[model samples]
Target: MPKMKTHKGAKGRVKVTARGKVVAYKTGKRHLNYKKSGKTIRLKGKKFVLFKGDARKFRVLLPYDWR
Candidate 1:
């Protein structure tokens, strides 16, 4: 009888693509980057899809995002 609210945190951090896949930025680039390799630095900010299991979980948190 009640509508579900979107998870605010997830809404800010995750994005739903036109095809309905959940995309999120990779972690571990925020600090101590000087010690990391060039390749790691280059790769850190890229977006990636959530695994099927995890995606299923986010689907509920982002109920309206699938459409």
Candidate 2:
């Protein structure tokens, strides 16, 4: 048997919460801010839980994150 490797890219971009929920920052926060509204920029800075389907995918990438 072999251990699974964590996906480095996902490791840097995603976070696993204490409850095992996967979270990630909303996109569109970087670049071209001048064209986006203030509210849009503010919302983009917040972290949001990934949808169930997506979270499952990230879980595989972050196997050791589950406690």
Candidate 3:
């Protein structure tokens, strides 16, 4: 059989946690920060877990990593 291929884009942006959850950096942090609230900015600094529906679809792309 052919080797499993990793999703390069997903590999760059998402991380699998030890418990098999996908984590990604929060969005809206890339631009227009001056209008964003302080709390919003702080929150954007942290990562968030992917929803169950999305995770299932993405898991197929990231076949090798389960976390």
The candidate that achieves the highest lDDT relative to the unseen native structure = 1
Error of 3 at 61 (Å): 1.1
Q: Which stretches of candidate 2 lie over 4 Å from their true place?
A: none
lDDT score for candidate 1 against the true structure: 0.92
Cα error, residue 52 of model 1, in Å, equals 0.6
Q: Best candidate, TM-score-wise?
A: 2
Better of 1 and 3 by TM-score: 1
lDDT of 1 by residue, 1-67 (tens): 8999999999998999999888999999999999999999889889999888888999989999997
Candidate 2, lDDT over the whole model: 0.91
lDDT order of candidates, best first? 1, 2, 3
1-53, model 2: which lDDT tens digit per residue? 89999999999999998888888999988899999999999999999989999
Question: How close is every model to the real structure, measured as TM-score?
Answer: 0.92, 0.93, 0.89
Stretches > 4 Å off in candidate 3: none
Local accuracy by lDDT, each model: 0.92, 0.91, 0.90
Q: Report RMSD (Å) for each prediction in the order shown.
A: 0.8, 0.8, 1.2
Candidate 3 lDDT by residue in tens digits, 1-67: 9988998998898988899988889988999999999999999999999999988877988999983
Off by over 4 Å in 1: none
The per-residue C-alpha lDDT of model 2 at residue 23 equals 89
State, as a TM-score between 0 and 1, how close model 1 is to the true structure: 0.92
Candidate 2 at 28: error in angstroms?
A: 0.6
